[model samples]
Target: MEQLTTSLDVMFILLGAILVLFMHAGFAFLEVGTVQHKNQVNALVKIMTDLGVSTVAYFFIGYGVAYGVFLGFNLDGQLTQAMTEKSGYELVKFFFLMTFAAAIPAIVSGGIAERARFYPVLLATFLTVAFIYPFFEGMAWNGNLGMQSWLETSYGAPFHDFAGSIVVHAVGGWIALAAIIVLGSRTGRYDSNGNMRHVYPPSSIPFLALGAWILSVGWFGFNVMSAQAIEGIQGLVAMNSLMAMVGGIIAATFVGDKDPGFIHNGPLAGLVAICAGSDVVSPLGALVIGLVAGALFVKAFTWTQKNLKIDDVLGVWPLHGLCGVWGAIAVGIFGSTALGGLGGVSMMSQILGTLAGVAVALIGGFLVYILVDKLMGLRMSDEDQYEGADLSIHKIHANPPKEEF
Candidate 1:
């Protein structure tokens, strides 16, 4: 019976690992559909390569940094001991989490698309996945360095991210913000007078919608599987995620005046916001959170581009970073017993933890990008940007429909 339970747990997490891995396709397609046709191939290639490199970095370096598990160079020896100790579960857990960590680069890729140098971005992906992300992840999930203990002692609860609304989404968003700022806007994105002069619309709405659907589907595994054990599963988490998704849809639809881009990203914003507290909050609370997240995404994305003049191609910072911060804090509000939630969470803890994540992500991302810029440069030349990343880096256009005729 014990063996059977252990096997079930392994299977559950392994399934989750596969599902989250599939989310990479969603990320790739989302970027592909958003960037100009000339840069579409670059988007696809970058996501795939980033995932590949991230896998290597996480296996050899990141997992150790996060959980203190050293996978020595000898794979044969590690597997033998793992099988004997019935600790094969750890392998699947790493697979699941490695997907989450890899998402940092995936998120950043969208913001810096079209202008970032490919190999340099790959290096950033490796460093972010290997070191920066795991540092915060270790503190949040694994209690590394006693940060969790200190939070609990000080605020009456450890930082209460049931999943990774703050840990993963917020961290990724902030890091993307840092990268985008350092890399600057894509060439011709703004005017010589510091006015917003460019408007690069989506290349394929169908592909964009398809990517959102894939992410929505895979998110079930992303959130539910975080339970990591069948015994720990709760239907509330699934239901909350659903409510938040629809709430985001409704809110974005109305607020965005039916813009397809906003409509599609609305659900993503909600899902991002609900990830932290889906298990604890009521469906209604999740709905409110989703609605607010949707509005926030629309408002923030527009303001950043038009007012602040930040060129986040896919609005990753707003969809993930700001909404993630709200989700982290909302868990405190909605997770209270007074609010029809499972209790034992502290708002102060949530705030502090969320702030800590932002600080780490921003500082770490800036330093990594700045160091890379000085050493090897980060953005492509102006000539390369005008030529598009697909042709400049990949040596192919996404589609030569004009020439094919």
Candidate 2:
């Protein structure tokens, strides 16, 4: 039975890893559908390349940084040990978490699409996946540097992020914010008088909607598979995710005045918010969280474009960053026994942890991007931007003119 259990655990996590890995496709299609037609190929290419770069970075360096398990080029030895010890559970676990690590670049790709230089962005992905992200990931999940212990000792409870609300989503969003600031707004996105001189609408709504649906479906694995074992799975998590998704759709539909973009992204906002507390919060609490996140995304996305002039093309900061913070904090509020939850959470710990994540993401992202800019530059040339990334960077348009006979 023990051997059977180990094998089952390995199979479970492996499946979870594959499901979460599929989420990358959702990320690619989402970006492809959102960006202008000229930049669609660039979007697809970035997600794929970023995934490749992130995998290498995490396998070689970030896994060590986060969990003190450096691969150090010992592939055969590592696999042998992993197989003997619990049927390679650790290896499959790595695959699952590596997908999460890859998501940082995926999120940033959306915000900085169209105008970022290709190789520079790849460099950023390497540095971030191999270093910055793992630093906080170590703290939140692995108790690295005793941060989680200190939080629990001081606050009566450790921060509770069952999945990766603050660690992945918020960190990605804030890092994207830093990259956006460094890259500046896309050319002609705004006039010298701070007026909107150009508007880039979605190139394909069907593709966008398809991407959202894929993400929404795959998110169950992203959340539920964080359990890492079949016995740990809960129907509650699935139900709560569903409630939050629908709640977000309803709220964004009403608040965004039935905008298709908002409607599709609404469920994503909710899923992002619920990730931190899916296990603890009641379905109703999850719904409320979703509603708030949906409304917040619409409002903040519009406000940033108009007031702050941040050219976050997909509103990643609002959808991921702000909603992720809310998810972390909401765990304390709605996860308490007083609120029909399982309890054992602290608001102060949640706030502190969330703030720590934000600070690290912003500062680390800015420093990395700035250093990369100084070293090799980060933005496409004006001529390149006008020509579009598909043609300028990748040497191919998303849809080339038919060849002459």
Candidate 3:
């Protein structure tokens, strides 16, 4: 019986890992569909760069920092028994955590798409995933300073993030915010009169729709993998994630005054919002959280663009930051054991832990962005910006003519 249970756990973990991997493709298509034609290649480049850098960083330093040494080893000794388990299941856990580290910094590239220097962006990706991001992951997800340890020692129940609202999404969103602030808006995004111009993307809407669908499917793994121990919990997480996506779509359509783009963004917001507490909340609660997240994302996107004058090319802040906050807080509101074997958290502890996670991510991300910007001059020259990164950086054109018959 024990052997069967162990095999099931390993299978679920692997399944979740596969799901998260698909999200990379989802992001690639989604960003490609949102940006202008001149910057389509640039958007794709950013996604590719993020993935490439993340792969190296996560394997070497990131895994050690997030799951192995920083999280498990203290001044005295290793923190968790799981870290020393030496079993195949333990190895799976390490790999699963590495994916989360890789995904967090992937958010930044989308926000700073067109004008960022490729080298500096690559550098930033390395620093974020390898160092800055893992620092917080160690604090929030690993066993030592992680929510579980904090809750076990300071409070009672663990800081109830079923998946990664604060750990992954918020970390990525805050880093993206910092990158945008340092890199500045894309060229001509702001006119001399200070009004923001509309920079439309060149890709087809079908691509964006396809990416969103893929990401929605990927989210099931993201939520379910976090359970790690429970069987029924994985099912619950998958169901909650789906319901939230549906709710987000419905809420975005109605709340955004029927803007199709806003409606389309709803599914992502819902997924982000439900991620933190998917295991704890009931399906109805997931729906409510998803609906609210969708509405908030629409408003937040508009406000960031029109009001705050922040040029988030792919609406990273709304999808990750604000919705992440909603997901974290939802743990307190809906994570009642009575609902379905979920979190039974106190309001104060949940709020405090969530805030702590946010603060660490924001501060660390901001510092890294500022350092990279000052040292490397993050943005390209005005000439390069007008010329487009594909031609200026890669020296390639989208539709080249044939050599002749």
Candidates ranked by TM-score: 2, 1, 3
Ranking by lDDT: 2, 1, 3
Task: Please estimate how well model 1 matches the true structure, expressed as its whole-model Cα lDDT.
Answer: 0.92
Can you write out model 3's per-residue Cα lDDT over 118-144, one digit (the tens) per residue? Answer: 888888888888888887777677664
lDDT of each: 0.92, 0.93, 0.78
Residue 171 lDDT in model 1? 95
Runs off by more than 4 Å, candidate 3: 1-4, 69-87, 146-156, 229-233, 337-343, 401-405
Residue 12, candidate 1: how far off, in angstroms?
0.4
Instruction: State the displacement of the C-alpha of residue 275, model 3, in Å, after optimal TM-score superposition.
Output: 0.6
Worst 10 residues of 2 by lDDT: 71-80
Q: Where is model 3 poorest over a 10-residue stretch in terms of lDDT?
A: 70-79
Candidate whose TM-score is highest: 2
> Which parts of model 1 have CA positions greater than 4 angstroms off?
72-80, 401-405
Give me the candidate number with maximum lDDT.
2
How accurate locally is residue 242 in candidate 1, as Cα lDDT from 0 to 100? 96
